[model samples]
Target: MAIGWLSILKAVPWTDVVSNAPKVADGAKKLWETVARKKAPTGTSASATSDTSSPAGQEARIAELAGELDRLQQEMLASSQLLKTLAEQNAQLVRRVYWQSRLLLVVGLIAVAGLTLVLLR
Candidate 1:
């Protein structure tokens, strides 16, 4: 009964899902736009704004953004190297299991044969 339920869940109609995804996205976008329009600021003033448009402010913003980008790149590189190391370790583990199982199979066969000989005698 559990197997039947799992099979039913696994048998998803992906083509239908792909076809309907665009419609769902469109509906969500429209809903978000309406909500955003309702919540928009009613007024703007120059005194309330920061000097980001000035040359000095622009240079500072660019330096800050560059620093953030460099940090993110370093983090990405570290994660990628860690992933590679884990994948290599997983492959080694799989090989070790395969060889150990083969050894166990041979030992089991030998034990079974010895038991058969003793029983016959």
Candidate 2:
């Protein structure tokens, strides 16, 4: 007749154990803190705690990030507008160059025709 391990585990006073767990955890935490406090160096822990933990510090950081985002957005808009303006100017320049070349070709053909007529006579 083996006393099964599962039956022994189930026989535990689970409610009483659970009720005392928090007190036990608190004691252990305090004990660990005391030991760690003795070993840790001074001033090192203070600097590791950041200002962003507080509400006002968090608000300031959010505002700074928002301002930076706005600045980047405005810069992007300005650069895109400048790019559009440059593209328009480039298109106009291309049209002007194309027409100038056509005009020069027409004038050269007319000059060659006049010289031929003069030489034929």
Best by TM-score: 1
Compute the lDDT of residue 67 as modeled in candidate 2.
Answer: 69
* Per-residue lDDT of model 1, residues 1-121, tens digit only: 9997764444444454566557556655654554454433424356323655788866876786686677666556655655565565556556655665677689999999999999999
Q: Which residues of candidate 2, in runs, are more than 4 Å off? A: 1-49
The C-alpha TM-scores of every prediction are: 0.57, 0.56
For residue 85, model 1's alpha carbon misses the true position, in angstroms, by 1.2
Residue 64 alpha-carbon offset, candidate 1, angstroms: 0.9
What ranges in model 1 sit over 4 Å off?
1-49
Across residues 39-98, which tens digit of lDDT does each residue of candidate 2 receive? 333252443347667888678768866866776665566556555655655565566556
Clashing pairs in 2: none
